[model samples]
Target: MVVTDENPSAAPVTVPVAPKRRLPGWARSVLWAVGVVAVLSTASYLTGVNTLTSTNTAQIALRLALPILLAGLGGLWSERSGVINIGLEGMMILGTWGAAWGAYHGGVWAGLGAAIVFGALGGLLHAVATVTFNVNHIVSGVAINLLGLGVAKYLSTLIFQPLSGNPRQSPPVPTFDTYSATFLSDWLSGLEQQQRVGISDAAGLLNGLVTGVAPLTMIAILLVPLSYLVLWKTRFGLRLRSCGENPVAAESLGISVYRYKYVAVLISGGLAGMGGAALVLLAGGGGYLENQTNNRGYIGLAAMIFGNWRPGGLLGGAALFGYADGLRLSGGGKAVLALMYGLVLLLVVIVVVQLIRRQWLAAALGVLGAGVLYWIYWANDDLPSDLTPYTAHFVTLIVLAAASQRLRPPRADGARYQSGQR
Candidate 1:
């Protein structure tokens, strides 16, 4: 009986199709930042206006960036597991001390192992406080940093008290002579001879390059891709991310969130410790000193952010920061150098913010502003010599921050999961 009506009028079924939403502000900002960096890098390379020697600069950048990158990746693991580890600096310091102590008493490998153990202990402490007791992550981190510094200082005084008396001459770690081969010697000789005029220190250049490509550098290179693989392609990584994003979901799915979190935090601590060990053993020649890490832990944190929580991205960010640092350490007009460094950072941040917001116009304006500022500062010829390093340091910090802000972990990062909660 209803066949007449059904045939006469077939009501149209409208399927509700959700409108495509624009990218989040943060995501746009990251894109803008990347664009700006690309533009600037291209300009620098094409113009050859960048004062840095490409070969030496790259080598130096890698040297500094590698250690920090490793530490930052470790931080990524911990934070991704919903555990905020502020104790990275302290862990690194402990590792440095442990490695130095181990090397002094045992062998280099023993020292490295000691650093890892010490670092793991530091991580365990953080895990107990944050995961078990649910302490404020920031406070816990600060405490760890203070504890590390205090312990390191006391230990340094106790062990190197005699050496301290002689101030200039500190105890030496076993330094491997890099220029043992004839080919290496020939290369150095050629480099020295290449720049005959205005080259006051060719030896320094040669030594820096030779030392840059050390065993530690090689190890760090290997670790980068390995880290990427582990974080993205492994079961451990999945568990770690799940714990950070939605612990309840992961737990229901038969994942022990606590165990995963603990493991992640400890592994982070161990990696940071290894970074410290590398700094002292490979870079600083196995000596304990105050502020030996030189804010690298903090930098590593920024690097993690810059990399947008991606291992590959982190390497690039670290390299940029490292290059900025190298320039500062290279001894030039401090004020101008500082200005350049600041400009780089400011530009990077503005670009990042714009990208995140999908405001290309704003990013472009920021780049212009940075360029103007840089030119103004570059024109000033009377910068203080002593202030150069400080300027460079500030620049490096800014760049690192800019680069790190682009990093984005999975949606569930740094959150705790409870039963029945998504």
Candidate 2:
């Protein structure tokens, strides 16, 4: 073959490939949580702060995480199957009332069953609207929220008010007693009293965490792994996720998209309901009250977003939020205050660096950090207990705001899917 001038050189252009610079979301999440925990724990150990590492705080963190974790799992199931379920709040609210009603008549188990049923009903409504009628998923969810709350409020008047003469709250329901074995309990109690170096109230913390823990809490923790197994390791889970990612392709492949979507949504509702039941049970003999969910459903959704739609990520997100909540609920002592100030100083240094780098957003956050420091300083001696409960919300907001671009959802998640339409 004769080579012509138009033939050019026989060489392939080599564009340099960029190295993989971003870490996996799960690894980043785990590292972030561990770093925070390490920082707090080390501060406590070195300074004898005794603030964040107490048994009471650990127990509270678990208690706070259970509901959010359950709800986040529920959302994962539904959204992973191509349905956007914004009605989780309404479903959870119904679950609370159902739990109270069932406990009032039958028992705690019955209450749990009732909560599931109520949540399932809400899910059914959502499925019918979004899956069958082809209604907008967001609208359907909003309607469910309104309807669920109204139904619960009206039913409370007839069922709960007769018992307590207060339509807004139900009478005390039977609660699960704390589990404490004679030998284990005594040994742990004794261990707590005798502290060792580097451990510092570790026994007491462990005892507080395991003892008196509600059965539902254990179930919630177990569900984390169960969710991971079912969603990531099973054939059924793969099919369900396929439907969410591309329902048309799934339908072409003989997968029943409708069936998977229905199953996912129903399971989602049940999880949210269970979360409500767990919350009431965690209250320890206290009955359900109006608006008892306290926007936890929304918080759970935030956690699902934070977790990047994975079970392991969900666990980390739940723990981070739960720890913040626990801190808020249990105000710290002088040592804790010192640690807080130290953290503030660290934050201020970072913000100042950012300001020097001329990042406008960092400058704004710097102002906010300075405000926080001023507030802490103005408190004089003690930590501001009343404002603590909002730390979880604040942290959640900051994370979401900062990392919104990194978060992605299933492509076909909220789209209407009609067979053969794709």
Candidate 2 error regions (>4 Å): 1-34, 43-49, 180-198, 201-207, 332-386
For model 1, residues 1-422, the per-residue Cα lDDT tens digits are 12233555775556667889999755865775565444434433433334343345445666677668767877888888888777898999888888777766776777778888888888888888887777778888889889888877777777756755532222665422232335764566565446432231233234445544656566667887887788778988877787887788788898887788889999999988888877766753556566778778887877777777777667766766776666555535642444364456657777887889999986887787677767756677545766665643565555554445354566765454444555
Top-scoring candidate (TM-score): 2
Clash counts per candidate, in order, are 17, 1
Q: Mind giving the per-residue lDDT tens digits that candidate 2 earns over 1-422?
A: 23345547765556667787998866886676555555565556655656566667777778888778888888999999999999999999899899888988898889889988998888888998999999999999899888889989999998889899999999999876566555765676676556443344555456666767777877888898898889889999899999999999999999989999999999999999998897776654357889888788878888999888888878878887776777566645454464465466556656877878998787787678767865775586765667555677876896577557688889998999887886
Instruction: Locate the minimum summed-lDDT window of 10 residues in model 2.
Output: 195-204
Best model number under lDDT: 2
